[model samples]
Target: MGTLTSILVLSFLIFFHELGHFLAARFFGVHVEVFSIGFGKKVFSKVVGNTQYCLSLIPLGGYVQMKGQDDMDPTKVSYDQDSYNTKAPWKRIIILFAGPFANFLLAFLLFIAVGSMGVNKYAPIIGKISENSPAFEAGIQENDRIVMINGVLIEAWEDVSTHIQESVGKLELKIERAGSVQTLIITPKINEYQNMFGEIKQKKMIGIAPSGKMIEVSYSADKVIGFAYDQTIKATTLILTSLQKLVEGVVSPKELGGIISIVQVTSEASEAGIVALFALTALISVNLGVLNLLPIPALDGGHIMFNAYELITKKAPSERVLTSMTTAGWLLLLSLMALSIFNDIYRLTNGN
Candidate 1:
C-alpha cells in the first residue's frame, strides 16, 4: 500500500508541475502540441481541441510540448502564429517560469493547510553528545537548548542538522541551559556517513543528537499563514545551504539521491499517516522548484538564461550551441541518476 501510494504521489507532483506549463502556455496564446504526464511510450492519450493530453509509460517526470519550442528538434514541428517561439520574450519567460512557480505555490498551500491542523515540531535541544566528539569537547551537554549557529537563529532541531552538516571546520554555537545563555566554539569532526540510500558522504559532525521531545503546534486561523511561510523558507534555506556545501567540497556527491531514494522515502513517509505524507510532498515540491531553477541546460533555468541573453543581445543562441549544451545536460543528469540507483542498490544489499 505504501509503495503504491508513493508512486501515485510522485506522479501527481510531476503531473502538477507539467500542468502549470500547459496552462501558462495556453493562457499566453502559445500553441501546445502535447501535454504529457510522463515520457517514452504513451499509455493513454486523448485529443482535446488542438492539444493531445497523454500519460506515458515512464512516471519519473513529465513535460509540456509547445509548438516550435522543442529543444531537441525545434524545426521538426510546424507552429502556428501563436506557437511558443513566435511569442514575445516576456511571454516565453513566464511560460518557462510557471512550472517551478507552481511547485512552490503547491508547497505553500500544503504547509498552510497542515499548519492550521497542528504540526509536530522539535526544539533545538541536545539529548546526547558522543564522548570525545567535537560537541562533547565544546561542552555541549544534554538539556542545552541551542539558540543560534554562527549568528543564525536556531528555531528547531532541523536547523542544527543543516548547519552542522554543511560546516567545513569551525563553528560557533549558542545554547541556553537553566535560563542562562552561553556561547561555545566548536570544530566539527570531519567524517564520512553512509546515508539511507547507501551513498557515502563526507560531512562535518558534532556527534550530538537532537532532544527527543516533540511538540504539536496548532496554529490559529490568523497565524497559520505566517507559520506556513516560515516553514517553507526554512526548508528552502536548508536545501540551498546543503547544495552550497556540495559545490564547495564540504560534502560529497554521493550524498545526492535519485529515483530510488525518492521512492524509498515516499513509501516510508506514507506509513506515517496523511500528515507526514503531506509534509514530504511539500518538501519534494520545494526541492523540485529550486532544482529546476538551476542554470543548467535542459532545465527551466537554462532556458531562462538563454532567453535572458537573447533579450539583452537581441540574438538567440545558435541551434548548434543549444544542441550541444542540452546534450551535455542530459548526459550529466543521466549519469547522476545512474549513480544514485547504484547507491540505492548497494544500501539495500549491504546494510548502510
Candidate 2:
C-alpha cells in the first residue's frame, strides 16, 4: 500500500509538471505528439487527435513530447504551421520555462493551504540544552533569547540554524537573558542527525533548541500570497545554497539521495498524515523547479539558454552540436543519478 501510494504521489507531481508544458505548447499552437507518464514501452496508450497519451512501464517520471521536438533539432524538424520550431524565440522560451514554473506554482499553493491551517513558529528563546554541549558549557540557559550569531542579527530560529550549519569549530553567540545581553564563545560538537526522511546528516550542533509556539495564522488575501511566495523563495534559496556548499566540499556528496530516497520519503510522509505528505510534496516540487532552472544541458534552462543565443545571433546551433551537447548532458545527469543512488545504498547499509 505504501509503495503504491508513493508511486501515485510521484505520478501526480510529474503529471502536474508535464501539464505545464502541454498547456503552454497548446496555447502557442504547437502540436503535441505524445504525453507520457513514464518511460520505456507503453503498458497502455490512446491517441486523441494528434497526440498519443501513454502510460509506460516505468513510473518514475513523465514527459511532454511536442511535434518537431527531438534530440537532433530540439525544436524538431517541422515545416508545419503549428510546428514547435516555427514558433518565435520568445514563445519557445515560454514553453521551455513553463514546466518548472508549474512545479513552483504547485508548491506555492501547498504552502498557502498549510499556512491557512496554521504554522508552528519557533521563537528564538532557548527551550533545551544538551548536557556538556556548546551552549550549555557557554553558560546558556533555557529561556535565554538568541539575538545574534557570529555578529549577524538573528531574527528567527531558522537564522540560528543557518549560521550553525555554516560555522566551524567555534561560534560566538549573543544571548539576552533577564534583560541583559551577553556574548559567549563556544565550539560546536560534530554530530549526526537523522532527518524525518531517515536520511542522516552530519552537522555542527550547539545543543540548543527553540521554544516552540503554535501560531494560528489565518492570513488575509494579500498575506496568504505573500507568505506562499516567501516560503517558495526560501526553499529555493536553501537548495541553491546547498548546491554551492556541495561544490565547495563544505557538504559531502554522501548526503545526496536519488529516487529510492524520494520513495522512502513519500511513503513515510503518507503514513504520517496529509500535512506531512503535502509538505514533503511541496518541498520536492520546489526542488524540481529550482534544479531544472540550473544552466545545465538537457534541461529546460539549457533550452532557454539556446533560445537566448538564437535571439542574439539569429541562428540556432547546428543539429550535430545540439545532439552532441544534449547527449553529454544526459550522460552527466545519469552519472549524478548513479552517485546519488550509491550514496543512498551506502547510508542505508551502514546504518547512517
For candidate 1, lDDT tens digit of each residue in 86-111?
A: 77777888989999988888898989
lDDT of 1 at 326: 86
User: What is the lDDT of every predicted structure here?
Assistant: 0.85, 0.85
Residue-wise lDDT of candidate 2 within 46-157, one digit each (tens)? 9999899999999998888888877434535887999888899899999989999999999999989877766656767888889988788889998999899898987668
Runs off by more than 4 Å, candidate 1: 74-79, 123-211
Give TM per candidate: 0.77, 0.77
The CA-based lDDT of model 1 is what? 0.85
**Candidate 2 segments exceeding 4 Å error:** 72-76, 123-125, 128-222
